[model samples]
Target: NEQISKYAVQDPELEGMGTTCVVVMLKEKEVFFAHAGDSRLYLLRNGKLAPLTKDHSRVQEMIEKGEITPQEVLSHPERSLITRALGMENVLEPEIGQSFEAGNGDKLLLCSDGLYNMLSNSILEQILTENAAAQDKAIRLVQRAKDAGGYDNISVQVIEFQFKEQKIILPTTPLNFFEKNIDESSENISPTIPKVVKEKKIVDEEKVPKSEVKNTFQPKPEMSEKTPPAVKTGKKVPDIALIVLLVLFGVVLTLFFLGSGMTKDPKPSELNISQTPDTNAVAEPMNEEPLDNQQETTAITTPKKDEKPVTKPEKPKKIPKDTLISYTVQAGDNLRKIAQRFNMKTETLKKLNRLDDNEIKTDQKLKIKVRTVHTVAAGDVLSRIADQYKTNRELIKKANDMTDNATKRGTKLIIPLAKAE
Candidate 1:
């Protein structure tokens, strides 16, 4: 309203010129709406048409106060006299309707008073309930309203909710023993039992004697009484040969140590020096070169001072910048929607378009800042794409005007990069 008042102050012609406003936002399974004046929102579900908003008109107030009935609202003398509307006052308060749960095959209708004023609820319901596309229904409604009287401007917007069906999968049952080709004896045994138990059972059955298997009892073995017992000798003998060998080894070791100590070390003067370079030997003489000749050799090996040093060339750096593109406002488009489409804030969009409020009209041209374009490929997701571009998922979604994280293959998307500080 402050924006509107400012506009009105700038241009006197805009003074007292107000309009109705109605906005509907659709989500995965919910619907939200806000409105001012007589433009309304309706929902059609399961062939039942229900109004989601009430008008801020004098006839509506009268009906609420019991001075008139809802059926008479169409014919009331002050039916067009709205109690509230955009630009009607310095302060504007739009009725923000509560969000409601949405379902598959639901149809939402948003139209100006011009539509409901000509067509009754029954007529509107009958048309919306027909099996037709949202566009067709909107066209039919407008045509019918024009046919009725065409007393005012007609504007209609139709939105259809489509939800993907969910498929339930049941758990599978285990195969029977016959189908699994398992032995009947093994079927009764628990799978958790250790393999050692089965192996031990087989060994015990094999080791059982035939007589013991037939009878339930077995006798213990005993030695015969006449059997003779062997006895061990109690006398101890010394190892004389081992002692004699130990004495011989000690005498030999003592003789070996005494012989090693008796040996004398060789003196350093008696050491051999056959391979050493003898200083006493005569030295060979060589021809000496001139100082000038040596200087010439050094000059030949030196590089020229005029040669320039080699250095690598530097590559140019490319700085990223924001790009501006034109966008045409389509049906159901608003300033907020356009802002999101370009991955920008609403205030930024408003500032770019120099709009003082959120109001926008169909077919209006908008300027959008796009960093680049990306063609979605197979296995592409919002998060992965955002990471690849060094951005965020929300920014990508807003730039592409996507409500969900789903991305279609081969779809061209506008990537909006944030401005560098």
Candidate 2:
């Protein structure tokens, strides 16, 4: 309303360009009305009339405030003085009438003050109570007001209402793209108990022979807006017979396979193997070499002419019952020299000391748990020393502390020295 007032009544030159009365009504279950000035809205129900809008004129206000009685209002000079009217200024505050419950056969009448002023309430009720249509009632009411010397412009509108159930019907046409796709998918479904429609669209079941069994389905004789869509069924009698045949064939094939897979037990001689692994056919290697090369290797190792067969140096006898002695390596000594000085075999000395070779360094101490000691005599060589001690020559050399095949008189030696085991 405020927004309308801001933009309305743009013509300032027009003075007193206002209406004395105006009324508007919208029809629905709840009827709505709007009024400004001295208009009226009346609802005729069960032979009684009720006002839905109030007059905003000066005389009406005077009656409301008890300043004047209802009887004096007809002749009141202020009766024509309306307090409100549209287009009188830039803004209007029209009264929004309270809604009324409307129903079938209900009549709503709207009229200006001129018509109501010329006619009495009893005449208005008698006109509305007549058994006539809305147009006829409205015409009679306006004509009666004019007949009573109406000096003002009169206006009237009458509306009669009725309510009924409303239904929206859909068109019956061929299925659309989406619906056809759905139908195709449902048709392709292969249920074992698929529903089947018979060949006949109409069936007179009374005439069917009692001796003949038939699966019958009936179709609608006509199509209409209210008719439901026809149900598309599968192949009729052939599908059932075909399904039965398929089941029988599957059962027979299963039994045949079971019977063919069984047999009696057999002896070993009746086995179907083509050959045995013991035959040469499968034994010979694909890449065998000659034996001549191996024989030549032996010949080369034998060393022909005056070359003697090399034998490993023997280890000396065990040192006397685990007794050992320690010796300090001296200058110009090797493992052989140390073994000779300790009266042990060179191989035995190397094994006992965990030596890598005959190499020895000066001033390094070697441990041997001493069990016995022997002293070199004037006539004693390493061989004689070992023979008398029941040991080898290298043991005598090691015992006598000889680095070479030499002997010295009065040399103290560890006879057959052995490391701690």
Give the Cα lDDT of each candidate. 0.54, 0.49
Off by over 4 Å in 2: 1-13, 20-27, 164-421
- RMSD per candidate (Å) reads 46.4, 59.2
lDDT of 1: 0.54
Over 157-220, each residue of candidate 1 has an lDDT whose tens digit, in order, gives 7876544343322223222312364565565644332322111111111221111101111221
Tell me which residue pairs clash in candidate 1: none
The list of candidate 1 runs beyond 4 A from truth reads 165-421
For every model shown, the clashing-pair count is 0, 20
Q: After superposition, how far is residue 113 of candidate 1 from its true place, in Å?
A: 0.9
Worst 10 residues of 1 by lDDT: 270-279
lDDT of 2 by residue, 111-209 (tens): 886567666656777888777666677777777876765545568877765443322222233224224577658876443212231111111122211
Root mean square deviation (Cα) for candidate 1: 46.4
Per-model TM against the reference:
0.38, 0.36
> In model 2, which range of ten residues has the least summed lDDT?
272-281
**Residue 301, candidate 2: C-alpha displacement in angstroms:** 99
Top-lDDT structure, candidate number? 1
